[model samples]
Target: MDFARGTKLTIKYNGNVMEVTYISRDEDYLTVKLQNGYNITIPENKIDVLKSSEPQTVKKKRITLKHGNGTPISLITTGGTIVSAIDYETGAVHPSTDIRRIIDRYPYMEEKYTIAVREFDNILSENMQPEMWIKLAGVVKEELGKSHGVVVSHGTDTMSYTASALAFMFESLTGPVIMVGSQRSSDRPSSDSFGNMEGAMAFSSTNVGEICISMHSGTSDNSISLHRGTRTRKMHSTRRDAFRTVSGKPIAEFKNKNVDFLSEYKEKSDKISLSDKIEEAVSMVYFHPGLSGQDLEKLSEGKRAIIIMGTGLGHISQSLFPSVRKIMSMGTKVVMTTQCMAGRVNLNVYSTGRELKKIGVVSAGNMLPEVALTKAMYLLGNYPDEDFESMMNMNMRGEIMEREFLGDCY
Candidate 1:
């Protein structure tokens, strides 16, 4: 018998019957998640009670709210720190979720509309491949034709990549596409699972347009913030309220069961999502200190488009100029974005700016690097079939913030 992530089983511990909603397997121990959301780690040698009985069958009363359904939405889960749990045996975290578990936990959502859930992959977001993005984009296309909105449970790490990719691919959208992750795992006492899930549920079940990341905007379950997918970033590693709006502001807020908009949202057309395809080829190269041109060459090889995550206002020195020009000369579109997660890139401020602009490097404005990478993918996916440079320079969603508004922590 396979003990998967969301397996429903019962364990009789100390004469107490506890349902094992989730299992975190480690090298030498197993951590079980209880109904009330607690992880009890038991070594393989614990007293008896290892029987695999079914969980208690209890009927639940549903509490639901009204929402929209004209446009279909889907939630794709790619394994990340958010869905991960402790495997005591290995002392490593494992990401696992079952669609049934999600639905069971939030049965109240059935009242408003319906949802379709799928797991894109079970790897950390850092391990998310561009191929996964392609497959996920395809999933969105399929779901857009079926559901009203889509929510993604991703690791906070590479969520911005998927979010930006979807935002770019879904040109003009009707329903919402939300990416959600937690600062802590569902097994931890202070995990952001419940809050993040609630916020994502609110955004997806509502009549919002465009792709966004729904996460904890502040500590303590006070509110869940909906940020423009392209403009959001995880600001802290351990803080529950780690996600923040970069340069621009969040799209909206979910508090006390209410949806409060920061401003008028982009209206959705009859064609909800942009209804498009991604570019076939693109590469993302992050600029670091003492980086060599060969590094750029290796990534840009055979790539038709490149997004450079430059340091500080999008400035790269003369050392890698030859590589930048080489890629541009090969008709490989290169975009310049800031390594500073919180600011926009301005090529006009420095001599390096003139050099990059001279070599056909484009400024990505306030677009996040992940957004740029996904945008490049979406644009490059167009390939010989489409013009990437033209689309890559435009704002598909809030990915490209025309203006920057710097602010202090909320």
Candidate 2:
């Protein structure tokens, strides 16, 4: 009855015999993972264990790193699902920063590329902060100096935010800086981590010099998309193709170990430089129905810059106009972005928008709310106070689109 975790078991449940992997158990129930990658909990008395075997210990073949004749690439691991594996004992996915474990999974990488490995941090992407972005920028700059390109393995949840922050921090790059993540952890059969990482490796060998996210183009594994970091957003929660480019096309696509350019991209620069300063006092608020001026004031209090994700074309409740004016008068920059998924924020289309802008709510034209937040942080951290408004409107790092096109929304 005391089966170890990962022990193979043959059990009779509901008069049917099945083989499952023992995960965990409690006083009232037993938990096991089916062959199809799903966990089920059954009443302790409802199943009869027919046989059990000890967990298998398979010796993995060690893959030694060697410099190859291909492009030099650095693999930076910052904890995420891409670097996580299931802990059978707890039935929970735990992240790992072991570069050897990762590299061992794909030994072909060592055969095709001169690979360098760095364990940046092993924290989830949600725990990422502006200070970490600055530090990451420094590490990336150092790695870029030695490698032809860099591939960052990150958690999918906040990958876009980090990618956007990096895009703004590094004005120019000598090689492609591709951030990659997987919706499914690498241990599962449906895992996209392999394809995404392979795509990142392939794209990194190219001459593209901008920060971009490499993810599945669709549910199928045939192709992967390269999205501009600032223009990308994680659209689906658990889909293989979660990240999408908003209001624009993907920069490129990778298939058959080759990268095909889909849109104009920044080629490699002569030298790399970074503006790592970031203002942590920026806050982003989503405008909701019945939100009071006091609510806005409380949220915007003591923040240097506040990004309001306003309703349709960036219109806030006219009732909150006084609070917006007060926040701006106190030297806190107020920028408006759309709550809608795809479209530019137009202040001249509606009277409420006009009123908000007249009182000094700068429009974050077509920039995603999350992107606007990072851009505000970047601008506030490095630029003078007077230059904030003008720079916000400027299309820096492709965050803003000059024209809207049909069929751009997903």
* TM-score (all chains, Cα) for each model: 0.74, 0.82
Distance from true position, residue 402, model 2, in Å? Answer: 1.2
Model 1 stretches with alpha carbons more than 4 Å out: 1-75, 81-121, 272-276, 383-387
Report how far off residue 7 is in candidate 2 (Å).
23
Candidate 2 stretches with Cα past 4 Å from truth are 1-64, 86-108
Over all chains combined, what TM-score does candidate 1 have?
Answer: 0.74
Report, for every candidate in turn, its global Cα lDDT versus the true structure: 0.71, 0.87
- Predicted candidate 1 versus true structure: per-residue lDDT over 1-410, tens digit per residue: 34656556666666767666546667667777766666677765652445564434323222222244422346666776665556553344655444444556666555555555565666877887766776777766666666677777888877777777777767676577788988787777888887897788788867777778888877888899998877777777778888888776787899987888885566555675443566656777888888899988888888777788888989876899998888777777888988875767888888989888888888888778877877776665554524555666777676766666757734
**Against the hidden true structure, what lDDT does model 1 obtain?**
0.71
Q: Over the stretch 1-410, how does candidate 2's per-residue lDDT look in tens digits?
A: 56767888999999999988887788889889887778999998999999998887543222225646867888787888886766755476645534555457667666678777677876778999889999889989989998999989899999999999999999999999999999987778999998898899899999998999999999999999999999999998999998999877899999877889988888989999899999999999999999999999999888999999999899988889998888889989999999898988999988998888789889998999999999999999999999999999898898887875566566
The alpha-carbon deviation from the true structure for residue 379 of candidate 1, after best TM-score superposition, in angstroms, is: 1.3
Best candidate, lDDT: 2
